[model samples]
Target: MADKKWMPRWFYQLASPRWCYEITGKLLPLFVIAAILLLVTGTVWALAFAPADYQQGNSFRIIYIHVPSSILAQSCYMLMAVAGAIGLIWKMKVADMVAKCCAPIGASIAVLSLATGAIWGKPTWGSWWVWDARLTSMLILFFLYLGIIALNSAIESERTAAQSTAVLALVGLVNIPIIKYSVDWWNTLHQPATFKLTERPAMPAEMWVPLLVMVIGFYCFFAVAMMLRLRNEIIQRERRSSWVRDLIAG
Candidate 1:
């Protein structure tokens, strides 16, 4: 019929800033609510339900925080880059907003990962820091995130910032792959993956389940944080527009 034919598919319709922003606005609350619930449930489960590791004992509980934050840190960077790319390529304001929003969230995860790793290391690896491939690549990732964030903020024009940061994000992406593979290639001091199923992880389910929950929780946490920041960006970027005022007034 005319109505169905008139309606454009997802990509073609999302080509509009208003469409993207409006749809995202609707979803934001859902992400936030779910994130909070999951994070709380996951944290409680990880901390309370998980059993002590055979080797690390209670110290192994650190896995809940450290591993999750580390995984989130790298994933957030890729998320940011994709946001930036969509913004630059499609000229979608919402995409740029999402990218700008990701900067601080990504940086925070990286910091959390580093901090938790350091704490875990002193006890496990007998050092607070190391120059190993895994650690060093993660460090590089942190800096790369910081650099994209700085560039996005430094520019006077929003479009220019998106374009510039997109380039940086693309370039910095190399480190993500490196970080993932470093442990295998280098035979570094860092321990191998703690939780595996088919082949069995070095650790037991007692320790792994909580860690997995925490990982899922971190994803939710990051999703909520990014959406919150993106909302703020949309408001600022669209400040002079009528839609924002309506959103605010309503």
Candidate 2:
């Protein structure tokens, strides 16, 4: 059993819906603060401080929002798939709840990514839309997120919905890499990644630093949003339990 002393206490606590709710309730404020501070600072820096692109000029500023949304959408989808797999393999209800909540948040971010991408393209490519591989793949990812959400709502049984959506999330995992590498694998108008870990950033520190801050802020925002949803899911799922009743009563 995972109850051995070698196992971490928090690892065991993750299996308990009540523990997850209480812990997230404690952590949500911290994440919210971080999200607000970083987002405000990054937005100011990106808009007022960062130098305009020589070629694209002010139009490039959209990247501060676009890049973070794109990255977060992919990350959120991966997390959803992994959480669903965990719920399937281990029968963890908390994990199931978490996977369920990830859908709408991720879908919203995906929509933001697409919208910002289109806006960016209008100035960069002189068109609002194109059949570029990167853009097409991202659209497919957005559709996949929608499909999961639809499948979950269409199913009446909660357990069946989770399992069915979990399988769909797993299958959709194939599109993530496609969305990430489409620029490289095929010739398209979309640009390659500006930030790479193995090499220094192509842009100056003033630009990249704020972008990094925004990326961190976006992740924090996602955490806050997902935790809020997960807590509500926990309460609804565990409403019959005495602890939840006590929590609600008190």
RMSD, each candidate, Å?
A: 3.9, 1.6
Candidate 2 lDDT over 5-85, as tens digits, reads: 776778668989988998899999999999999999999999999999989999999999999999999999999999999
Q: How many residue pairs clash in each candidate?
A: 0, 0
Candidate topping TM-score:
2
Per-residue CA lDDT of model 1 for 1-250, tens digit only, reads: 1244665588556655557667777987787787777778777877787776667877867778889988889888998888788777667677777778887888888998888889988889899999989899999988988888788768998789889998899888889989887888897988776654557666666666657767877887787677667666667777778877887799
* Model 2 residue 8 lDDT score: 75
Any idea what lDDT model 2 has?
Answer: 0.93
Residue pairs that clash (backbone atoms under 3 angstroms), model 2: none
